[model samples]
Target: MWSTKQLADLAGTTTKAIRYYHRAQLLDEPERGHNGYKQYRAQHLLQLLRIRRLTELGLSPASAASALENDNSSELYEALTAAERELTAAIDKFNAMREDVRGALAGRSFGDLALQLSDKPPGLSEKDFAVLLVMSRLFDAETVLTFQEILHSSPRTPVDEAFDALSPNADRKEREAVAEMLAEQTRTRTPENPPYSTRGQGLAEAVEIMEKSIAHLYNDAQIEAIRRSWELLRAQKTASDT
Candidate 1:
């Protein structure tokens, strides 16, 4: 028979741990003797040693206790299997977060011109980055990759700068001129009309979200100019096809 302190020291744990185990119903408390000191038996020492061994094996305190309580070997195996699955899921989540951080550090670039005209283009504002973030959620990785390539090969001209500088309150004549210029540029730059791929739905959704974001970031006149430019470009394409 040994005292609580002696059992704790022999088991390589503290007295506080023994008391916690008692409260957790993991350890059986010994009865008080005539001198008012609790007497711990060999069984108590063995249980404490078992708990320390289980903890060394990476079993949580609760799992260790529950595994010890199971008399059947199969039940213990089940508990350990569940712990393994939880660890794997945690590892996967961490890996995904690490990849996202690496991407941020690498610089997802855009330009002052249209998104299609810049892979690592300069003059991207914080608002433009915000739109890309939204777009990233709506589109898949492949579509965005292709879009970036298209932008990288695009030619930069003075007209692109004019559209970028266009004010929200631009007059009708100014809007029309910008839109017509943009349409002509689109026609000259992208002469080949490839069939839109099925993957385009994701890009379309992302573009819609980006347009909404642009509405909040740019003034009404700028937004109108952009809308009119796309419309005129589509009409020009239709006319050429006929």
Candidate 2:
């Protein structure tokens, strides 16, 4: 027989832990002595050791109690299996995080674009990065990878700079010229058959997000130029098909 402190010391834990075990009903409450102090027995010490062992194995207090009550129970097996899977997943996640950190230290960008792209396109603006970040979440990974490849491989031109610098109140003539240039560029660069899927169950939501992003990220003239360029491309495709 010993005091609570002695039992805790023997179990390589703290008095606070012993009290917590009592509240959790994991350790049996011993009888009080003449001085009204609890007297712990060897049985209590063994029980504390067992509970600590189960908890160290990643079992919750309740699960540890359940495990103790029935050592060969299926519930204990399931708990152990779940703990193992969680630990394995956590290890993998941490390893990936470490690799990302290493890459960043070596001057590589990581995050929304990094997973799909080796590096961002030259002269990619903050607004473009924000749009790509949103797009990464909206589209599937493969689609994003394809988009990144296209952006990386396509060279920027004076027309791109003109479109970017277009004012919100730019005249229709300027917008149409920019649109025609863009449509021509798109025809030369874009594939006749796109390598990525644009149709899916989430297509409607994806389109809504893209429309909102475009409206928020670009001015009126830029948006008009984009819209006109798309229309021109469609018209050209229609004529070719016919």
Alpha-carbon local distance difference test for all models: 0.59, 0.66
lDDT of 1 at 113: 14
RMSD of every prediction? 24.0, 21.9
Strongest candidate by TM-score? 2
lDDT of 2 by residue, 1-242 (tens): 46777566546689999999899888889999899999875456557766775565456899889877776646755765665555545665545544433443344433332433223456655555445544554665556566666666777789889988899889999999999998998778777754434435365466554655447568888888887887798789779989
Q: Each candidate's TM vs. the true structure?
A: 0.41, 0.46
lDDT of 1: 0.59
Q: Which regions of candidate 2 fall more than 4 Å away from where they truly are?
A: 1-123, 199-208, 238-242
Can you write out model 1's per-residue Cα lDDT over 45-102, one digit (the tens) per residue? 5567656645543457888788778754465456545544444456555454333323
Q: Residue 221: error of model 1 in Å?
A: 1.2
